[model samples]
Target: MSERKVRVIVAKPGLDGHDRGAKVVARALRDAGMEVIYTGLRQTPEQIVQTAIQEDADAIGISILSGAHEYYFGRIIELLKERKASDILVFGGGVIPEDDVPKLKAMGAGAIFGPGTPTSVCIDWLNSAVREKWARETA
Candidate 1:
């Protein structure tokens, strides 16, 4: 039987107007054989989480370059937990500082790929992490 392709919801939260990086990552994920849903910029936390649920996505990746990663991600995590969607892997990327990455992860973020991270690296991490999460869920 063929393996099920991971479905990911790539969203841009907040007022961050720049989406070049988000687009790049989305394309890379599509190329990596995952089904990617790229939600355009200016999405609120609720919209993103709702979309993830509606899409039945295995992962939610938010791209925030507006320096409000902490607030946005925090709210997203809270909503996910409230909606019992914590099993959905939550990851993000953008101009986040190295120091903030750990804090983000500590708050339920799976991974934070900083600016300039190779697309391949992000893709690989997502693939492996999603597989692990999927296996754990099924088991």
Candidate 2:
């Protein structure tokens, strides 16, 4: 049987108008054989989470370059938990500081990528993480 493609929701949470990086990662994931949904810019936490649920996404990749990574991600994860969709993997990228990485992960984010991190790194991690998430869910 053919394997199912991993579905990822790429979102720009908050007022961050710049989406070049998010777009790049979205395209890279699509090229990597995953189904990617790019939600454009200026999305709210509720919107992102709702879209993820509606899309039945296996993961959410949020790109925040406006220094509100903590707030946005925290709210998003909180909503996911409240809605009983916390199993959907949450990762983030874009202008994030190294020091804030641990905090974001502690807030239920799967991975946090700072500027200069390669797109391939994110893609590889997503492939492994998504598979592991599905495996755990099924088991």
Candidate 3:
């Protein structure tokens, strides 16, 4: 079988109208040869999860600047588990406080890219993480 490109769903969840960061990340991911499907602004956690599963995405990258990271991240992770889609890794970025990073990570977020983090950092981490996950599954 032919190898497929890594598919990622980049989303902006909740009523947060800020999307410049999300758009930037999506573009960066796409430029790095990943197939990116942007769920656009104000997407609910359910919608984002549904889109990811439907698109067979390897990961979901959420961007939230509305200070509702805890709810959105936790809910998405929970929903993925509930639907047996935990393999679709969840990661996020935004104005989250440093203290909450560990909590979100504990909730199964692969990584959290805070403000001013270089896109290359995210790109590299995602590539490595996806590669490792694929290896584990194949093994």
State, as a TM-score between 0 and 1, how close model 2 is to the true structure.
0.97
Q: State the lDDT of candidate 1 residue by residue for 1-139, as single tens digits.
A: 9878899999999897999989999999999999999889899999999999999899999898889999999999999999999999999999999999889999999999987899999999999999998889889
**Where in model 3 is the C-alpha error above 4 Å?**
none
Provide the global lDDT of candidate 2 against the true structure.
Answer: 0.93
Alpha-carbon RMSD of each model: 1.0, 0.9, 1.0
User: TM-score for all predictions?
Assistant: 0.96, 0.97, 0.97
> Which regions in candidate 1 have their CA more than 4 angstroms from the true location?
none
lDDT of 2 by residue, 43-117 (tens): 989999999999999999999889999999999999999999999999999898899999999999999888888
Minimal lDDT window, size 10, model 2: 112-121
Number of colliding residue pairs in each model: 0, 0, 0
lDDT of 3 by residue, 1-139 (tens): 9777899999999998999999999999999999999888889989999999899999999999999999999999999999999989899998999999999999999999999999999999999999988988899
Model 3 weakest lDDT span, ten residues long: 1-10
